[model samples]
Target: MDRRHCLVTGANRGLGLEFVRQLLARRHHVVATCRHPGKATALNTLAGEYPGRLHVLPLDVAEPRSHAELARELALVTDGEKLDLLVNNAGVLRGSERFGHVQPADLEASFRTNAMGPFLLVQTLASQIADGGTVANISSEVGSIALRQEFRTPSYAIGKAAQNMATSLLAQALESRRIKVVALHPGWVQTDMGGEQAALTAQESVAGLLQVIDHLDEDDSGGFLDWQGQTLPW
Candidate 1:
């Protein structure tokens, strides 16, 4: 694969951080974003090791103003260069509070961060994304209404489901530009949110996901898929 310029959100830790590591290892230029640059010790350390290849930016995904700010900053940094990949990997998982006990604030927070953030980011940066570039929105099987067997993680589920819809809508909207947008399930990886008992490690999950992303095309846009490139029932 040719070297590409990539941007990943929530890149200070867990799956997001792993994505940065692997992308940099593949020799791709990467812009890694987190809400707080000062506290991103690991990410900043990686920046030192990778030198000019890695750039870290502060981004608060839930804030619309932050989205606008990031777009402007990136436009200047890239200086007309287009982004080959945009990974909407930043997300939050409020615990599976029972329906009656679910807090409206938690639900709103989840939706803002997990759903609206990614959707707005795409909208703000669409022009900077290369024609035919790929947008991978990290989603989960829990978001699939067809697969729902229990009521758990309502806030997280709702947000991810909305994220899935955003991916579909963006795929259709960006079709003229040949930009492929798709939702992906990274599996139950052992991240802060996934917990230690999770079946997969961050490295394992991201490795499979990168493979899936590598092969995505216009035909795959608007589809929901797992890390192994398997089609998921929406």
Candidate 2:
């Protein structure tokens, strides 16, 4: 199980934490990052429980400076450079404002966290990853044009759209190195973001996502897929 180390952003709680938990269960070392790790008692407990297997790093994906620090930390962790899977999971929503009520500032915040953040993370961490590494951008089906509707989160929708495009662009660019890139939509799950009305539980959604990751291959790279393995429309 020493294939490679995993770094998951937004790993303080919700699906991100669940992803870390599941990966650890599979005997994979996980570097879970959050903006405020000081108060993340659950993550601290996991780190304690797993010893060297679970590492909790303080990171804010929305901040570019943190990317440099994360790089430095990875260098120390791997001697020079080595991390297998990099999951771009950190994201934000501005109080769930409706479409008509979507503030420009709110849209800016959404795009920054959902789209630009992931893009920057990939750009900064590309060197830290070994060849043939995998990057998963936790995207959403709401970004699907073919599946479109007047949603409440225009900014979120647009951001995921950009993220999907980034996924495709990076996939082709990194194709020669065999670095797989994918936009994964974890199905409607109960979380602070997903709200209580969402269908799937966080456990179930993350479990499905992990299953999809476990089955990833070179051919599957650049694909926009749901947690259930269904291909999504652009």
Q: What TM-score goes with each of the models?
A: 0.98, 0.95
Candidate 1 has which clashing residue pairs, if any?
Answer: none
- TM-score of model number 1: 0.98
**Residues 6-108 of candidate 2: C-alpha lDDT, one tens digit per residue:** 9999999898998898889888878999999999899999999999778888788888999889888877765664778999998886656675677888778
Candidate 2: list runs displaced more than 4 Å: 1-3
What lDDT does each candidate get?
0.94, 0.87
Error of 2 at 207 (Å): 1.4
**How many Å off is the CA of 59 in candidate 2?**
1.3
Q: Largest lDDT belongs to which candidate?
A: 1
Minimal lDDT window, size 10, model 2? 93-102
Predicted structure 2: lDDT: 0.87
> In model 2, how many backbone clashes occur?
0
